[model samples]
Target: MKKYIVVALLCLTGLVQAQEALFSGQQVSSPQVNDDKTVTFRLSAPQADTVQVTGDFLPSVKVDTPMGKVDGPGKALLTKNEEGVWSFTTSVLAPELYSYAFIVDGFKTTDPANPFLIRDVASVTNIFIVSGKQADLYRVQDVPHGTVASRWYDAKTLGFDRKISIYTPPGYESSTAEYPVLYLLHGAGGDEEAWLSLGRTAQIMDNLIAQGKAEPMIVVMPNGNVGQDAAPGAGSDGYYTPQFMTPETMNGKYEAQFKDIISFVESNYRIKADKAHRAIAGLSMGGYHSLHISRYYPNTFDYVGLFSAAIMAREDKSGAGVYDNFEETLETQKDNGYQLYWIAIGKTDFLYEANEEYRAMLDKMDMPYEYTESEGGHIWRNWRVYLSEFVPLLFED
Candidate 1:
């Protein structure tokens, strides 16, 4: 028994040493942000024939898509060394959060050395931040941060307990203040968690409030897809791949059922609960929802923002719920009075023409609004910039 025990101990010791050596031997520090504001990415794939890096930091090349010419991600080939290690260094990158992946001999993969990553719809990419003025608010600073909670609310209209992400100000838990509410919606293929994760809503809010650039308000993000109970894997469907479009997206169901979300928010949380103190904004499909919801239920949102929004009216306009009374609704919303109606879109956005038509309609009605056009297309980068700029303009009263 003593001899057997000694042998087992020796084997265990060898196994541990092997693991340690294996890790230490192949370990190469990737994503080395150098002193000159450049980034170095290294991958140890000696067996691979070719390796290349692709990221948003690279020069964007215009690609022809169905939505006109949109800027697509660019790639750069990495040089290999004697040790079979492939590496590529980027030129001075601006201070911003960038996502990248490695294409190894035609197969796309992420850096094994870097674990930090983010998911947009079905695609997952590794991310790193070049810290500077552009990304100052993207990181978690030493300032007081707000609490973000994934609360399950009763959606009576949808007949289910829907998931909603809420961001309360830093002192919300401790203070008795009734603050204004901002309903922040995500684009198609996004869920309640989209704004918090991709949009960096909490970080932006915390930094802005800490700097006294924006008012402290509660931000609510809800899943706009009425068919799905929650986000992709978060709903009754388990671990299913996320798609760009889901059932009941633009069929006027979500807009009609949106009141349940508002009701749940008002009843449960301490809010101003009035039109003057309420704001609504979204990107892409969510922007479509925002435009319709704000106008459909006139006087509900005093502040309305459409960020790269899809502005075309439904083809089936038989004067039914939500889609019914389009111009009449806008006129009512205009007459009911609003503090701000902000419309923002990218110059190359596919929906740019649609937005132009919508703006023309608004102009024809002599409706008051603030129009801001940016450079870029239907992408998250512009959306983030919009959010950073938009929140400061909300609830100044």
Candidate 2:
């Protein structure tokens, strides 16, 4: 007992020392936003021989004339000053959220000074938002904020308890209103937390609702990984890394399991619970899931959105029988009379050709859909923009 007590005391003392060491320094301003809209990034790695900063702020180049632009991994070298600080200033960046990292002595790491960070699958990086004019839509304004909850529900189809992230509009608790629901999905390697943290879904919805651009609604973000019940470390089943390359993770399990999510939402929330009031949208793999789910479950969702969707012409068993009886399914969906079918992708996105092919197919079938072509490649920036645009058009009649 005495030995155990001494060991605990020593561990406590070491922890205190470590905490002090973390903050013992002259505070340096990092990721400093300048009046000119340029950003200054700084790091105090005195021992590092070389330091470089890389981020989304760097413009992507057009590799092929027709293929669109692609962002290559690039970095800007920072200059070390006499104060043992390495720093770099970026050119004036457009208003948007950007993720960045530092490459010091051949190792990449997040900025030590920045507390705001986002975890994307296996990696984590620091993030900053540039705000003004049109970009303000992605920014958090002084509007009435919505409430976001991380909750779990039983997925009888999957035979396990699953987790989801939900956003209820402001006044939802007090008001006796039956609201509309938007089922938002994350891309490959993402889970329920993706939209809440990286996509800024709450802020976008709140801003739009405050401006009367979008109706007050309940947003549902569900984990798309079938093998995993929730985001990594959030479930008792243990942390399962999303296997994007394998059929086990990409299989139609989630598509078949989607109904469970809807049932849970309808039962728990005061929602309209009708085809016209229900909407579905997603990005990347989530977009693919949305396409399949809306296709198979015709007449269930009146509005559907696909952002940088991973579309293919061939049928695959992994995707819940996607492209199986494709014509018949679409015809049935069209006949069911959806309010809106929207597809948006970046001009430089690698999926640009696939989107064009899908558009051609839609044209061949005489089905109607609103197509939006924006600037940028397959990225979260475009996904956020697409959501803001798509939400305002929902349930508009």
Candidate 3:
């Protein structure tokens, strides 16, 4: 027994010693930079076919950071002595956080050097913000600017507690004034925090508002996910419904779950409740929601935005003809006096065809709307570009 105890103790000590840190300290994290606005990143897999570093600062470049441009005795070659280890210095970025990732073959991965990351569903995305972009309204600038708050409440209809977040503009408290409200929604699998963390919304909102690019509207973001991992069919309700089917209906749940959000905001903040001051928008699944809500409850909102929305008619692959029930809803939205119904998505997204098809359908339906498309795939870059383009058009009257 004494001999066995000594062996176990030795084993435990070895195990503890084997634990190596991915990161060093509280400040040492990915998405962050060293004091000199530069960083040396390393990955210990020499056997891997090829490795390339890509990030927010560098879009889709097939090379390591610096690539000998920043500091290399050679041209982008990571020199290793005897032990198989690779090291390279990334480019110098402006003072702020920047997101980056190392790509091995076809797979995208985060940098081992930094700790800050944004989870892209199950996969993680390297994300960081470059501070002081035209004095971003929401970033930490000496004194903390306003923040986005994520809170949960019981949604009786869904029988489950749901969540929502609000982006309070800078000086939201100092001024005693009522503000317009923009209800933002995220795509499926996303939660209320997606907009703040992924979209950098608080900063975008603050910057836009400060720059007079966007009106001073209180932006409200809500989770549009189905309550269950699967909804009714593939979902959890013991019913067999299609994917993206929340009990809230196909994007139709907008009026139901989000109605609570409106009531809460109105009750809590100095906000304008009339149609002229209210707005709603989303991306992908959210875009579909925005479409449904804007069409179904035309009287509630004046500004309607669809970012990479799933707004087109569902294609019946069986060639059974006729997909989605849109006629009545179209008439209803037209009957209501809403002003803008803007639609935008990446040119290369799977939903792109649907958007074009939907636009053709809209032409036949005579449903007036705003539509635009730019370069890029179905990702945050397009969404961010969309926001920069779309927000300026809101509340124009």
Cα lDDT listed for each candidate: 0.88, 0.86, 0.64
Candidate 2: the clashing residue pairs are: none
**Model 2 alpha-carbon drift over 4 Å, by segment:** 1-21, 24-26, 61-73, 239-247, 313-323
Clashing residue pairs in all predictions, respectively, total 0, 0, 13
TM-score per prediction, in order, is 0.93, 0.90, 0.72
**Tens digits of per-residue lDDT for model 2, 49-142:** 9999877787654444222455544689999999888899999988988888999999999888898899877678899888886578778798
Please state the error at residue 355 of candidate 1 in Å.
1.4
Q: Clash pairs of candidate 1?
A: none
Cα RMSD of predicted structure 2? 4.5
Mind giving the per-residue lDDT tens digits that candidate 3 earns over 161-198?
Answer: 66677887778888998888888877765657667776
lDDT at 190, model 3: 62
- Please list the residue runs of candidate 3 whose C-alpha ends up more than 4 Å from where it truly belongs after superposition: 1-41, 44-84, 88-100, 103-109, 129-144, 228-255, 312-325
Poorest lDDT segment (10 consecutive residues) of candidate 3: 66-75
Candidate 2: Cα lDDT at 332: 98
All candidates in order of TM-score, best leading: 1, 2, 3
lDDT of 1 by residue, 202-299 (tens): 99999999999999999999998777778877778779888778766677878878898899889989999999899999998989999999999998
Please give the distance, in angstroms, between residue 323's alpha carbon in candidate 3 and its true position after superposition. 11
